[model samples]
Target: MIVQVALATGFVLILIGIYGALTQRNLLRMIVAFTVANSGVNLVIVAVGYLPGRTAPILDATVPAAEAAARIIDPVPQALVLTAIVIGLGVTALMLAFAYKLYEKRRSLDIARFSELKW
Candidate 1:
């Protein structure tokens, strides 16, 4: 039940973020919405690896390493989500830089007004 709820919430957040990104024209708003969607995706990925009745993945003398490995949460999804987070940060930085340059060149923040770039 808990996992189901988490997954549903994540999907709903992702949908809302995508809708905002698609309909909103302001560059800053679009970037924020994209980040929102990325967060939702990250949440879902992390949730998928959760084990309800498992101990931590630490290998102390009390808990055997092999036993922990058998019941501990999956680490693969966590690792991939970390990578996704780094990539998302890079994309956000690049988008912000591009947006800043556009604002400087055009002296306007209205995305609609940026139609006729000299590109």
Candidate 2:
């Protein structure tokens, strides 16, 4: 029930972000929407990899090594999501930097105003 809700929320966020990114002509707004979409994707990945009633992949006195595989949740997706989050941050920073440079160059944030730069 909770997992379903999370998945639905993630999908909804993705759709909303995509819509915002596509419809907005402002560079900053589009970057913000892409970040929202990226977050939604990360949520979906985590939700899909989540296993109910499972513990983290840690072996202690209570959790024996032999039963670790069956008792613990998969860690791969979590790790991937962590890495993706860092990469996403870097990408967002780059996009912001580009936006700043473009603004400084043209004094405008509207993407349509920069169409002449197209090759």
Candidate 3:
């Protein structure tokens, strides 16, 4: 039940982010919406790794043998998410830089005013 709710909530967040990104004009807000979408996806992925009848993956000898035998959550996805987070930081930095340049070029943050390529 918890996992299902998490998945549903994540999907809703993704939808909201998509809508905001499509309809909003401010560059920074669009970036923030993208970040929200990314978070939703990450949450879904993490939720998928959760096991209801399983114990934590910590390898203490005190853990019961049967619980330890239950297939552990795949670590690869978690590692991938860590790498993605780092990459996302870079993407945000780049997007912020472009936003700053846009502000400098037009002295405004409105996206509608920069429709032309030459300006």
Q: Candidate 2 — what's its lDDT? A: 0.94
The C-alpha stretches of model 2 lying farther than 4 A from their native spots are 117-119
lDDT of 3: 0.82
- Tens-digit lDDT string for candidate 2 (1-119): 77798899999999999999999999999999999999999999988888988887679987899989889988899999999999999999999999999999999999899987698
lDDT assessment of candidate 1: 0.87
Candidate 1 lDDT over 32-115, as tens digits, reads: 999999999998988787888775556788678768877677888889998999999999999999999999998877778877
Error of 1 at 112 (Å): 1.1
Model 3, range 1-119, lDDT digits (tens) per residue? 88799989989989999999999988889999999998888888877877766645666776655766664555666777778888988988999999999899999888898888845
* Residue 21 accuracy (lDDT) in model 1: 93
User: For each candidate, what TM-score against the reference?
Assistant: 0.86, 0.90, 0.84
Cα-based lDDT at residue 105, candidate 3 = 93
Q: Which window of ten consecutive residues has the lowest lDDT sum in model 1?
A: 53-62
The candidate, 2 or 3, that scores higher on TM-score is 2
Off by over 4 Å in 3: 62-67, 117-119
